[model samples]
Target chain A: MKSPLSLEPLFHVGPAGITEPVVVSWAVIALLGLGSTLATRRLSVIPSKGQTLLELVVSTVDSQIRETMQADPAPFRALIGSIFLFTLVSNWSSLIPGIEPATAHIETDAAMALIVFVATIAWGVRTRGLRGYLATYAEPTWVMIPLNIVEQFTRTFSLIVRLFGNVMSGVFIIGIILTLAGLLVPIPLMALDLLTGAVQAYIFAVLATVFIGAAVGERHKPVAPSEKEP
Target chain B: MRIDWWTLGLQTINVLILVAILARFLFRPVIAIMDERRAAAAKMLGDAEAERAKAIAAREAAEAESGKIAASRDAVLREAAEAASAEREAALATAREEADQVRASAETEMRWARAAEESAASDRSARLAIDVARKLVARLPDSARVDGFIDGLARALASLPEASRDGFGAGERARLIAPRPLTAAELQAAHDAFARALGRPVDFAVVVEPAVIAGLEIETPHAVVRNSFRQDLKRIVEELTRHDGVHR
Candidate 1:
């Protein structure tokens, strides 16, 4: 069996080599773009079934953004919604024969985390001016600034690691079982992998919301004890 | 694990492109349509409420007009009832007056008819009594009764004054009316008796009149002596008619 950690290029282009995960991400982008276009082609006051489904997805994303970020969903909807969609689709791509899920690769997870890191700063700067954004690190005391700064990079690193580890480990475990026990024996594990992939996508999107919410302004209201994450 | 910086950059670019596509195509359009739908619903609700208020006002106006019409109808009915009552009363009074006049006329006619009937009956009775007396006198010796009536006629003539007796015996021929045709001897006897009573001779022409009912009457040129049962009955009937007239 091939190492799950190794990257192999199907083709090399001049000086740079394009790996499998990069190509798969392009496919995910094309699929989402095409689906979004077709779903939104003929919008009216009264919605068709496909249009309603798309609206439901958009509303759900908006609800999530509002609940997690304590802010309007409009500014963050594209970034957070795209991340979740891409990760979820990429993770589910494992069901396709001869296609590795892009999120199972560290490169894809890192790229998604890097986009979140950049968007967090941009949103924070837009919400509060640059100086105010910088001043947020010294929040209850100036003594916490260095720790807060390190916490930012570490959290982004954690997002990358968390997604890559869960997805890649599920892929590796299913691959190992398929190698040892044959194809049908790995079906249950693949199903678990699919579940794990969906959960990881949710976690990634929520964490992005939390990080962005913190940067822009936590604006956190008190939640009921029952509503708190246990 | 090995890092692929090239793959990372490409994936990042891909994700950004996806974000742009989804935001432009999916979220913006959907949210806009929802906003539009909400606005349209609100506008429809406002229009419906306005129409409902207009309908209510129209219904109320109709009810008000109906109430006024009902009141007018009641007034008209009241006036008609009063007019009808007055007309009925006047008609009843006129009918009563006409009935009373008819009754009075009928009563007057009845009284006159009763009086006339009574007069006819009395006349009939008198005639019947006269006829009965004639029949009775005929059953008796009529010649004997004629001598009594002749004596009554002589007495009536003797009661006259001398100048009246002379006038009675003088110019025109005198007539003697008898109840039956008298024989020549009776005629001569009546003439003698009449002449003796007058102290001058009276020429009395004899007349046979059964209507005298067994009595005699003497007539001269200017005077008459009535002495018969028919004359007596006529006198009694006249007195009774005079008394009846006075009572009336």
Candidate 2:
């Protein structure tokens, strides 16, 4: 017997044929690119309408970096600001008709996590030199080196799983709700989808900022009283 | 659930292409614009601080200038007061000097007026004495013999009196004929002048009085005569006039 929540497609294409999800992902990317380009082109002293909207988004991301990094935003500005906007748009793409959230798939989520993980490692090594960055794992002594290395792999795995699980859960719930009640019943769940989209985007951006901050050590250190002392 | 490897492969390729294009074109340019905006905010904050400092400096300079102007004004006022006081003192000194000169000239004029009045009084006394003498002689006789005898009598009346007389009797008459209250030097000079005429030692006392004003008198145990009556009357009248002038 077929489960009520089964999502198996009704039709099939020939070998190397495209699916609806792939086609929708491609269209979402194109839309995001067009919107971003129109918003960015022909910059002004006092921004044009589209430019103003883009500046608002970029400035919001920049402020978050300044708050988290708390140091010169020069180094982490490019990576963190890009990740924030990209994740936000990608997560929101599922709201359009005939499209699915690509982040709900493990492969897509892993790709994004890998970008952050590689950047984190690169920045850590660059800031403290390779020897120093690797030595951070040793922590107390040489005896803990193996455990520290295992911890690094676990951390990377968790990053990929966390985003994947959350987004997949939202899709699964929406599908289950739609199948049970048919059309209008999915409206409340759709509202929840919008919230979930924005929350996921925020979590991904903040986590990236925190990871970069950790790489630079005292860069994102708490705004302690001693900071204002000197 | 079952795995679908082929579907996953195609989806992976599609996702990769989408991410790559979006990252390159969309996110990259947005971040660039953000950086430009951040730099502009920092510059504006710095400019505001600089303007605040400049405004404070300008205010301080204005205060200093006003303070200097006030000090100069005070100094000018002080100098003006001092100049005014000096001018007042000079004027006062000139006024005092002129007043002193006027007072001195008034004192000199009063002295001259007093001397002229004294001379006029003395001339009147002399003229009255001469007139009285002429009247006395005319009552006696106008003949040459009688005129010559009266002239001789008048001469005899001017002679010195005896020294033993006292009071208004014989002694008073003698005092009226002789000088009283005389110093030893004046007595010595008088004796030296009259000793040759009398051919004897002479001693007398002289006193200043209005009783015998301008003429001499003689009195002795043997004889007595007076020629000082009219001169004494004239002196009395003049003194009475001076007293009346003071009262008036």
Candidate 3:
């Protein structure tokens, strides 16, 4: 008979049974906050090189807001930009020797996806006033309300699965390649891990913007011709 | 591997609390600072734009002031020129009036002096003539001949240029004849002037200036008439003297 692989406790938990991924996720968040704070310490009207890079990231998030929301985007500026930065760093955690990527686990991905889903619902209700937001589902036919309700749940599911699958796949592939090669031959696969980490972060942010945009439903059309007609 | 629901549920709750606390404490303050910075930048830009507008307005005002000063300067120059011309005209008028007064006084003095000298010379000549005449009357054959010669000499002295013509008998007279028609206005003015002088209108033929100059003479018929080039020349010369001071 073959022996099963013995799984030992990776690390100690606190009184509340906090696991490795939770601590690593917090660490990743702290690192991202520290990096962003240091980059923008001396905020200049004319940006220095480092601040320019930070500004480029912020403006990219702002542009995504402007495109997907089709409005001034003042509201989503901090929310989406912080999410992108945090996710990007956390997805890169496994590259370090002692730290595993929190996003590789379904629980971490679910927390991130839930943040996006709740934010999307809150913005939709805030912009469209609850009754109008619910009426969006009755479009094309009043009978399709149940299907529309399922769609909202499916969107949250898809967000969680997509992030979890991509991060988990990259980690598993790199682990398998290392086990087989056992040496420097696994370098290319680790390189791919870095690439996948960045790509996954971008995909999560983009999909979040799209889903939020769909829930918000066109945001009253910035400049409506009908309002000007009278 | 068996699923551990207790571990998963506890981890999810822990993560939610941590995220909420982090977002509230760290991210919120940082975002607020960023928004404040953005507002300050926009305010600075607005202030710069306002200052630029004020500067442009000031420049335009300066240019307008310059234009007004230039226009005022031109107006002052024009007024000065008008004042100068008025002064020159006034000076010329005063000079002309002074000259006319000097000429009138000079003429009056010469006339008085000439009258006194002529009276003295005439008295001496009359005395001499009287003595000579008395002697000649004594030597002559009849007193009537001496008296008649004295009368003839007196008439000659009175009409030195045309004494014989003046002595013509009442039966003899000169008349005028012309060859062309005259304008109605000229005829009417002449007739009106004559009627005013005579207290009654008279009929007369009107003639053109060319016909009178070419065909008429001074002694033509019942009255000695002067309607020819000689008369026209005299009238033109008299008019030129009045207008141009040639004879004055």
Candidate 4:
């Protein structure tokens, strides 16, 4: 078997290589897109159960964004919700035999982090002027510019590392246990892995909302109980 | 660690595309429909409130109209009662007046009828008195009654007005009316008594008139001396009739 840390190329398109993690990510995307289409296609004023579930997921995403970011969820809902769904589905894909979770790989996690980083800058520039966005680093004093600038990259890196470490550690530990013992031995660990995957998804989404909210410089909504402290 | 730049870029693109697709298909549509439903509910509530206000106004108007109608009806009833009362009073007054007129007419009729009866009784009494006087006169002694009448004529001639006495004395001839043919001695005695009372002799022609009853009537061209039962009875009858007419 290939190393868990490295993704072998599944195939090649001309000179470019198509890796297994990328293919898995495509499948996750396709699944999410198809679900979104089917769920919203027959929306009505009165709802059936399936439509109710769809609305519940959307409202829950909106609520999380509002509580965590302290801003209206309209501008941030798509990016944050997509990141959560992709991470959750990719991570939980490990339940299928011989299928490794995509987030267990560093490349997928880095890609999602990069997206959040770029989105933060883009939203900040759009919400405040470009000068205002750059000026955010000079909060407290001019001397903190270097530290604040470093913290921007460091925070994006932290978002990537946190999700990758949790998902990869669970996958690695489960793979080692499954190799050492039989599948039964890793069952509880696998359940714990599922829980870890869902948590990681939530953390990734919430961090993205926080980063974007800070960039936008608006706290329109009320904060949650846990976030009430500084 | 090995990183594939191509894979990182591809996944980023895929996530961005997914974000776009979900925003279009799910979030925006659901939120828009929710907004529409909320607006429709608010509009329906506003319309219901307006309708309730209209219903209340109409009910109040109906109540006011009912009150006005009741007031008008009471007024009409009062006016009608007043009119009926006036009509009743007028009818009673007219009836009382008619009754009073009928009673007065009856009283007048009774008085007239009584007067006529009394007048008739007076005539009958006068006629009876005259007949009785005539019977008494016929039963009297002829010589004595004739002498009494002669003395009455003397008394009447003495009481006469001077103009009447002169008119009697100047007469070419005086007429003597008696109830019957006087006796020659009664005639001579009456003539002498009248001449002695008048201080002049009055020539007389005797007339037998039973209508004089037993007394004698001496008359000249312009003067008269009536001393007869028939004249007395006639004067009494006239006075009774005049008195009865005044009563009527």
lDDT of 3 by residue, B126-150 (tens): 4455445445544554323222232
- For candidate 4, the TM-score is 0.67
**Candidate 2 colliding pairs:** B165-B171, B166-B171, B179-B205, B179-B206, B180-B205, B180-B206, B180-B207, B181-B206, B182-B206
Q: Which stretches in model 1 have alpha-carbon errors above 4 Å?
A: A1-3, A12-15, A218-230, B50-248
* Cα-based lDDT at residue A33, candidate 2: 68
True contacts kept of each: 0.85, 0.30, 0.08, 0.69
Q: Each prediction's DockQ?
A: 0.59, 0.17, 0.07, 0.50
TM-score winner between 2 and 3, please give it.
2
Q: Please, what are the lDDT tens digits per residue for candidate 4 over residues A27-95?
A: 887888888788878878777898778778888999998887777788888889888988999999998
Runs of candidate 2 exceeding 4 Å displacement: A1-22, A42-56, A66-71, A140-143, A212-230, B1-55, B114-140, B143-248
Q: Can you tell me which runs of candidate 4 are displaced by over 4 Å?
A: A67-70, A176-195, A219-230, B53-248
Candidate 2 residues B135-201, lDDT tens each?
5534543232122222333344324344422221323323324212444554454445434434443
- What clash count does candidate 1 reach? 0
- How far residue A208's Cα lies from its native spot in candidate 2, in Å, is 3.4
List the pairs of residues colliding in candidate 1: none
Candidate 2 interface CA RMSD, Å:
3.8
Flag regions of model 3 displaced more than 4 Å: A1-16, A36-47, A71-79, A121-135, A182-188, A218-230, B1-34, B95-248
State the TM-score of the second chain for every model. 0.57, 0.44, 0.36, 0.73
Root-mean-square deviation of every model: 8.1, 12.0, 20.3, 7.3
Candidate 4 global Cα RMSD = 7.3
TM-score of each prediction:
0.63, 0.64, 0.60, 0.67
